[model samples]
Target: MQDEGIGSNEVHDIISAMDEHFNPRDLKVGQDVQMHFEPGADEGSYQLTDMRIELNPLKTLTVSRTDDGFKSNLEEKEVKEVIQAQKAVIKSSLYGSAAKAGIPKTVVSDAIKIYSQNVDFQRDVQSGDTLEVMYETHQTEDGYIAKTGNVLFAQLTLSGRKIPLYRYETADGSVDYYGRDGQSTKKTLMKTPIDGARMSSGFGMRRHPVLGYGKMHKGIDFAASTGTPIYAAGDGVVQRAGRFSSFGNYVRIRHRSDLDTAYAHMSRIASDVRPGTRVKQGQVIGYVGTTGRSTGPHLHYEIMVGGKQVNPRGVNLPVGQQLAGRDLKKFKAVVGEVDSQYAAKSGAAVKVAQRQVESQDDIN
Candidate 1:
């Protein structure tokens, strides 16, 4: 206000009023500020009649002179929630193609993660495949997106097979993505609980490196750099956490009846993960390290079934909850709604594509 050449007392009053709504110091560059002034009763000075600052596309803060003093208020632009459908051919990768199709990066990443249980991006996705996604967003009246919601529906076609999934909430208030057959997309456990690691050893009989004798390797070993985060394979209560002889920094979780997963040779265990503590799937339980009777930095991961260690790769894990009866009916209704909305927006999408092509042709 001083830079604008207002009188010191008047500037103080105006800024004080503005501070009641928002701090002027919090303003960012490129944010527009408009000031309207009227001639004061004296010829030498001008009165600040109105002041407006654009906070965002949907919100504005304004200060106007009132009978009592300067008054500040916030103005909100009209916003509405809308469903947007986007589809693209996979020329390279799902992330790239979805981005070109106008899907938000966050939504693309989230959709990929949800589908990772069923689809391998490197192996399953190929050129000429197609992806269709429908999601919700809160947008301004002029179509500026304010925020986005989860993918309501997603479809990926590989070769001649098409997989369609819908976001559904169960009567028990749990939400998860489900296929057309009402089966959840989540598995009992993640195939690999750690990210960016390679399997160094298999779960089978081998010559024990430390013992120098033939022995059963009860767990799989993932070679990773020290401090790489290790995640819990499934939601379970920690049955035990601590050092145990050769299994240094061991943490075991009991997931289900006769099912338990264990992580050993951890550099550090998560502070909150202890015996009897419940942890959700994908929760970080520890970090990889060569803490046990091992030769190098790696994670010793084991899945025990019926008190016997099993091969993690060959284990037949169970699928998540299946919607049946009334729940299935409701899920199908949701799927139908998503399909209708996608079809409704198909024409609009085609027009947009055509307009872009025509504009490019004109430029060329």
Candidate 2:
């Protein structure tokens, strides 16, 4: 029997009603639960009529107690999906320009992640540089955004060079962003591993600042504030992550059979970072500091090849994967789709801008 607060006194009916779809113990605090009750034939007794529970934004479960037992049903809801595209010119920073253009922070962050493989946003992006983004936003029918969707495509025009990337997935279920030529943007190692830092020193024979004598500077130095994050140059296992005599807090990662990178003068090493711990590219391994020797806060970075220190900026790093065979065929189709989408969206934006300008002219 259904207990709608009707004349059903049987506890078995209430148990049966909940057993079909949901457990009463699993109910959350913010969820809505409704119960219907009515007077029974006897003054002292009541009957249970019906009950409803909102499962989530898109679904609801309802139970009705009847003479036979409890009947249960699920109700579905409808939502709307909105597509958005935006463009902006860099004035101060990418974040500021994107915000001014009404681009969501999450989407802007995604764009930066995609571009970080090659462009150093901290260094490369300048005033007058342009950025374009095409993405989607999921919203309820009531116009409230539920969440942001993927960055379908993004383009960064920096210093007259237009770098365009399209999001695509390989047939093997791997997804990544690729250039217009179907080559991946991600490389074997990142050039500038740290964010918001400048090259204070380069690899060469120079007088050591603390040692006060002419010596070969094996590693490059990036001057940054203490506690700035330091990332792994590539996917590698930690070879060393601890304090040393002159290096202070130091970390070394082995990327290949012949390749390795080292970071010195860290405020603190990431707790999870240790010898034999595998770290991916861009994973924060430590923070900047002047821990070991005499110097202001900075990161002493080194790239070693075959046991010899090499210039990171000089080494020709292996480029990202090139799509071929079936993958290439699939990627070409994706490129076509992205181009069409971008063109359509850009055209629409241009028309809107032109209309606005014409209207302004008429007003003037």
Q: Which candidate achieves the best TM-score against the true structure?
A: 1
Off by over 4 Å in 2: 1-83, 120-126, 136-150, 350-364
Q: Please list all clashing residue pairs in model 1, or write none if there are none.
A: none
Candidate 2: tens digits of C-alpha lDDT, residues 1-364: 2423333445566666667777767888777878776777789776666778888776688877777877877776666677777898999977888899878888987787777778878778889999999888887775445678999899999988999998888888867788988888766577777876888999999999999999999989999999998988877899999998899999999988888999999999999999999987778999999999948999999999998999887885664678899999988898898788888887888898899999999999
Candidate 2: global Cα-lDDT?
Answer: 0.83
Clash totals, every prediction: 0, 16
TM-score of each: 0.72, 0.68
- Sequence-dependent TM-score of model 2: 0.68
Off by over 4 Å in 1: 1-4, 29-31, 36-49, 65-69, 88-97, 194-232, 235-237, 241-251, 263-301, 307-311, 359-364
Question: lDDT of all predictions, in order shown?
Answer: 0.85, 0.83
lDDT of predicted model 1: 0.85
- By lDDT, the best candidate is 1
